[model samples]
Target: MDIRQLKYFVAIVDAGSLSKAAQKLYIAQPSLSQQMAALEDELETQLLLRSARGVKPTTAGHALYQRARAILRQMEQLRADVREDGGSESGMVAVGLPTTIAAVLAVPLFEHVRKHFPGIRLQIFESMSGYISEMLPDGRLDLAILFRDSETHGMSVIPAFDEELYVFGHAGLKLRKTATTCPLSALAGVPLVTPGTVNNLRLLIERTFLREEVELHIVGDIDSLPALMAIAHGGSACTILPASAMLHRAENARPPMRRIVAPDMSRPASVCWSHALPVSAAALAVRKAMVGLIGQLHADGRWPGITLRPPPDAATLEDTSGSV
Candidate 1:
C-alpha cells in the first residue's frame, strides 16, 4: 500500500535477490527483508518465493509485481510532473519500437529530443510491434513508435508515414518475380531470409506465401532489415524490406540490391500512446517532435512511395507547432 513497500518489492523483483535489491536500494538486507515480509503479511499472500534461480514471484506475486511496477512508474511520472518547474518539459521517457523501425528511427529521434529537450531522459528498446503494444497499456513506455495498428487498447494512434515494402536480392540470383510486384509463388524456390514469422512483416509475408502455396526457403531468420540486408546482399539468400530502409545507407560491402514486388506489399509507421492519462511534458514534446520529423522525412521524398497518416490530435494544437 505504501510507496516504500512497493518500491522495495519492485527492487527485489528486478534484482532477483534480497541482498542484491538491498544493495541497489542502499538499504540493509535485513531491513529490506522485513519490509517485504510486512507487505506480504498485509496482503495475506506470499509475494515472493526464494529459489536457487534467485527470488521468484509466485502466481500471486507475478500479478502483484506487474501492477506494482506500473504503479511505481506512474508515481515517478507524477513526481516528476509535480516538482519545481514541473510544468517545463523534463523527466524520462521509455520508448519502445520494433527492431527495424528502431534501427532506422530511434537514433535520429533521440538526437532531436536531446537537442530540443535536453532535460528529458531517453530509454530505448527494440521488440516487435505486438510487444510494444502490450507494454504501452501499462506505464512501461511513455510512447511507442511502431506499426501494425494500435493494440494499446485505450491508446491513440498517430500515423506518421507509410513505406512500400520491396523484395531485395543479389545480382547473380535470378529473381522469379518481376520488378513491378513480388508474387507469392515467386518465393517458392527462393531461399528466404526473413524475420521470425511472429513479427508483423514476416506474418504478412507468411500469409502471402500460404495464399500461393509457396514454401519460402528460409536460409536465415533475422529481426531487422539491416541485418537481413547484410546477409542477403552477400548472395546467401533473399529478403523483403521497406525501400526507405536502404535510402541512407552506404553501398553494401558485398553486392548491390534490386527491388522486388509481387504486385503489392506495404507498411506504415505509427506513434502510439495512451489517451486516458495526462503525459509528462517531456513525453508530449517528444511526440510532437517525432511527428514533425516523420513529416519531413516524407516531404524530402525519402519515403518515395509512401503515404503518411493524419497527424495526432486533430482538434488540439495545444501550444505545439512545427513541421519537417
Candidate 2:
C-alpha cells in the first residue's frame, strides 16, 4: 500500500525469513509480521507463504514484488533528479562495466567524474559482459556497457564501438611478426588461456572457431584478466581479447597483440539502459561523460584495435546523447 510496506515486503522475500528481514530492517519480528499482515489484509491477498524454512512469494506476491522494486527505484530517481547543489547536477548513478572495458574505463571514468561532476556520485559494477547485460533490464543498474547489440525489449541500446579480438602472447610464439593479422586456422593446436565458458567472450571465441572449422586448444580457463595476462606474459600460453586489455600493460613489457584474421571476428559494444524507467539527470550526465571519454580514447588511438561507432539516431537518442 505504501513504499514502507513495499520495502518490508521485498526485504522479507529477499531474506527469505521474517526474523532475518526484521533484523536487517532493525525492527522487531512481531512488528514486521504485523506490517506484512496489514499489507496482505489491505490487498485481500497473501503476499507471502510462510513455512518452517522461510517465506516465498506467491503469484500475486511475486507480481507486487516486481512492481514494488520498480516503483521504489523510480521514486529514488525522482528524488535524485530534483536534488541539485549550486546549480550543478547532484545524485547517485549506478553503471555497469564489462571486465575487459572496465580495465580501461574504470579509472578514467572515476577520475573524470571526480574532476568534473564532483557532486554526482558514481557506483561502478564490474563483471563479465553477460552479467552486465542481465542487470540492464532490472533497476539494479542505471546503465551498462554490453558487448553485443542484440535487441533487448524494454531497453534502449546505443552502439558504442567495435573492438577487434586479437591473439596476445609472448615473443616466443611461432606466429609471424611481420603481418598484423594471423589466419584463424593458425591458432589451431596452439595453447590458449581464456575465460571460462560462462563468459560471453569465451562463447564468442567458441562460436567463431565452430564457424571457421578450426579447433580451439584451450589450456587454461582463467576467469580473471590479470591472471590471463600473467599466464601470457610468463609464456605459459596465449590469450584472446580486445586490444584494450593489453593497452595499460604495454609500458610494463606486455606481450604482442596480433589481429585474428581469415574470417575476422569482432564484438560490438553498446550502452544500454531501461526504457521502462525514467532517466534521471545525473544518469544522463554520467552517460554523456562516458560517451565523451570513449570518443577521446578512440580519437587518441590509445584504445587500440577499436573503432568508435556512430551514435544511435535521434529517435533512440532519448534523454542523453551518450552512446555505448
Tell me the whole-model lDDT of each prediction, alpha carbons only. Answer: 0.71, 0.80
RMSD of each: 4.8, 4.4
Q: Give a tens-digit lDDT track for model 1, residues 26-62.
A: 9999999899899999999998999887897788987
Candidate 2, residues 167-285, lDDT tens digits: the string is 88843356666767777888887889888888889999999998888988898888888888788877778899888787667566677678888888799888778764457666777
lDDT of 2 at 215: 85
Stretches of candidate 2 off by over 4 Å are 8-65, 85-88, 170-173, 177-180, 250-253, 313-315, 319-324
How many residue pairs clash per model?
8, 1
> Lowest summed-lDDT stretch of 10 residues in model 2?
315-324
TM-scores of the models, in the given order?
A: 0.78, 0.80
Q: What C-alpha lDDT does candidate 1 achieve relative to the native structure?
A: 0.71
